[model samples]
Target chain A: MSAVALESVTVHAGGKSIVDGVSLSVQPGEWLSILGPNGAGKTTLLRVLAGTIGFRGEAALRGRRIRRLHRRDVARLVALVPQTPVVPHAMTVAEYVLLGRTPHLSLLAQEGEDDRTIAAAALARLDLEELSGRELGSLSGGELRRAVIARGLAQAAPILLLDEPTAALDIGHQQQVLELVDRLRREEGLTVVAAMHDLTLAAQYGDRIVLVDDGRIVAEGPPAEVLTAERLASLYGAQVRVLFDGTTPVVVPVRT
Target chain B: MTAAREHGLPAVSAPHVGVPWTLVALAVLAGAVLVGLLVGPVPIGIGPIAGSALAHVPFLDAGTQLEAAQEAIVWELRFPRVVLGALVGGMLALSGASYQGVFRNPLADPYLLGVAAGAGFGATLVIAYGPTGVDGFVLPLASFAGGVAAVAAAYLVGRSVGGGRTTATLILAGVTVAAFLTAAQTFVQQQNTESLNEVYTWLLGGLATSGWGDVLTVLPYVAISAAVLLVHRRTLDVLAVGDEEALALGLDVTRVRLLLVGAATLGTAAAVAVSGLIGFVGIVVPHLVRLLVSSSYRVILPLTVVVGAAFLVLADVLARSILSPAELPIGVVTAFVGAPFFALVLRTTRSSA
Candidate 1:
């Protein structure tokens, strides 16, 4: 069964369709990258799959309907790293990451020894062990971005959803983060769905690309087929050149 | 692998404030309770109070050496007052912390959602319009109903106006309800000029008239509310991450929020009903614990209970002892300390931000 299946999903807000008639599926351990311009409903679609917002159509995980699942159960299956997470300035990095254990424990139960072990492993996985004792507000932008991903990693979910995970990070840190995520996916057999702004990075990592515009899927295929210069110009309304480095498509904007 | 292996798992469990701090807090509470029992206008020794308290315990042969009047002062008056102070203080602080966590606002207090104004209005209604010589519990019951009703109205209004999903709208709704209720209370006070003294006394807040009955009145509410808040301590920490992230982590954000607000409101109303509208305990005590101890709700909630209970009991001791025969209202004492401390917290938070 597919790891996630969204069939004709639609989200409406303020009398406008934010995500309309969107259907997509991801198999186990596959990385599906969503590429869209600003306000093209990429974030809204991710929110629907995360089960944080209401939707009209069916969104299922591992063949079970998401709407039928309890919030805690849905949380156990998927973990979301938001575009910009609220940082409690006083909370230590360890405490912030341990929040991922929420769905695993009973409502009234605190994090036990086992939960801490898992959280610690997640920290080590992200090379955040040294900074685990540091406050989140004290971290640099790249470090904070990694800490946020570390929190998502600690959730121990089978599927990971990242919304603009590379935003606000230096190119080197962005590469480090995407490489780490890819490593975790390969090793843990985790399914990955990411909404990415950088088309070249998306092409480098995504097993399949789904390009969306105005709440609808405009293109869906491998990076090479979907990222042609003509389509990019028409959709993005920019003069962009697509160069092929071996098989991966690299998008570069050209001045008029 | 080296980093993971070398770090081991123990580092993750390192607490910001550990067990020693808890012991110190408990010691402070015990000392405060002891001082409350021993110090008063009528200088009573700790021996007699301890002996009498132990003498009541089953199978204890401890004998009391106090005269009948002193025993009455110890058991009937001071003991109940101290217990009631602790309950009200602890409830207020716990509720305040819960409110802050739920709304993600550092300044949220137990009275933020109109409980004080509502209770004041309720008390004013009874004092001004009701027949004289009614049961003492009648006023408390009316105030309790009024406080709960005010919060309910605020919530309903918040929902209607701003969908209740946003905390700002709820807070604004609370301010609106508070203004209307305070106006109602003032109008009632104006009409019944003769009852102004009584209304004023109640509004200023005090535990001077507390008895065993008052202790019993607020106990169940305090216990249940404290339990609910304590259980949700970890959940409150989850909320620190904001609504969307918390939801992604599997928390039923709306349901948990409602449960917390309901529990805090219930306890705050009960505390206000018996003790009148005691201010600053909710806001100041939690902020103090956050400053001196740990900021995590897991630590803050429990430590604030002990610290707040002790703080209030000590404040009550000062309230009754400072003026001798003429008692200063307990609210006056808390506000005097609280207002400055509140300013300090505001400055520190601002600087940190």
Candidate 2:
């Protein structure tokens, strides 16, 4: 069954159509990357899917209209790991990740054993077990990004919406995070959708790519078809060279 | 890590969560309370007088002169002040913590949006001009009204700008409102120089003149407002990631914001109503509590209540007796100590967390 479906999704910001009539669908455990340039409504599209913005069209999760679902209930089914990791002061790694269990908890109920166990397990999955006791303020940017993903994992949501998940990370940490996300999908049947700026990373990890430009999907399907050198150049308005890194098509753009 | 299980308290599965810190806070509160009861300008000793003091009982009628002095001090003189301090302090601290949470800035104080400034003007009018123009309880009532009015004005201005979505705009509106209120207060105070001492002294803030009547008068409102905040702690957690995030978490952002802000305003207004205008307890106490509780309102909120009570009680003790014959306005004492200590804490911590 399809996990999340968006149809004719239109988003406006400052009276301009930022995401105009864009549509996408994801099956269970499938990975989809939404690729676009700066101000190309990449984050905005993620926000719409995350139900953080008002859009004209239908968004459904597991056949339920998104508008009808209670927000915390929706949060339980879908998690959004934003582009930036904004952690409040003095919040411990364990404590921060445990907030993912908030939807499941009653208004006054404190975190039980199962919640802690889930949070610790999620931390372990991301290799953040050692950092559980540390304050979030002390974390490196890469570690902070990992922490946010750990939080998303702790939510145990079927659908994960990530906005520029690897934007601030070093290459090593980027690979570690992406590989962990992929592993989560394969092992736990989690649907992953990331708004990605790097065409190479998008083509590398995504099972399918949706190319968006000027708030609309210019092309969609296999990375090979959607990430053509000619299309990349025209869409981003930059000089770009596309090469096959073994099975994956990688795009390297040169500023003109 | 389910490590500790005690009988009286709920078995805390999350040992690292706020349980231990809360115990520590309770211990400090007890110590502060004891100190407040025992110490005064008149030194009460341990051995001879202490023994005689213990001799007094309900059935035995062994009450001594020492017991009378103790009663006079504890019940008559110091208790009301300490109780008011604790109540007002707790109110300010909780409101501050919640305000900072709502704004998503640690720097945001409880009085951020001109409540104190406008209330200052209203209070100045009452103190300088006297309640002859109005009726009984007019001063505090006017001050409370002004506090609510100021926040309402700021909120309206912010909504007009962008539905309170923009922090910069909200803060700017608050500043404008404050400036306007301050100007009005200055003009009024200048016109009434005959009561300048009264006006300025009230503005500095203290619990010196407030007796049991003032304490009883302000207690219910502050307590109710604080209780309202405590009940809505979880909704505040949703607000930690900004309104958009909280909205996605199924909270009616606008309504919750209004409720939370209103609760804060009510609590702060009550505190101001009783104590005049004590500042920074709201900012400092919550930050300190967050330091101990690690930023959970579940932790910060209750801890702030205990710690704030203890802090204000201690500060009042210092304010009253530090100069013997003359007393400092509790606000001055707190600011003098709080400002330097705040700078030190900021310098030491590097970042607020």
| Whole-model lDDT values for every prediction | 0.87, 0.78
DockQ of 1: 0.61
- lDDT, candidate 1, A1-256, per-residue tens: 9999999999999999989999999999999999988999999988998999999999999998999999999999999999988888888888888898889988888777777887888888888878998988899988888888888888899999999989998899899999999999999999999999999999999999999999999999999999999998988898999999999999999998
Show the lowest summed lDDT stretch of 10 residues, model 1 chain B: B1-10
Residue A143, model 1: lDDT of 84
Q: How good is the docking of model 2, as DockQ?
A: 0.28
lDDT of 1 by residue, B274-332 (tens): 78788999989899889887789988999889988999999999998898888899999
| lDDT minimum window of 10 residues, candidate 2 chain A | A84-93
Per-residue lDDT tens digits for candidate 2, residues B231-348, read: 7776676677666655544456777777888888877877786687887888899878766556777777878888988998898888878887688899988788778867865575
Query: What clash pairs does model 2 have?
Result: none
For each prediction in turn, the share of the native Cα contacts (below 8 Å between chains A and B) that it retains comes to 0.69, 0.29
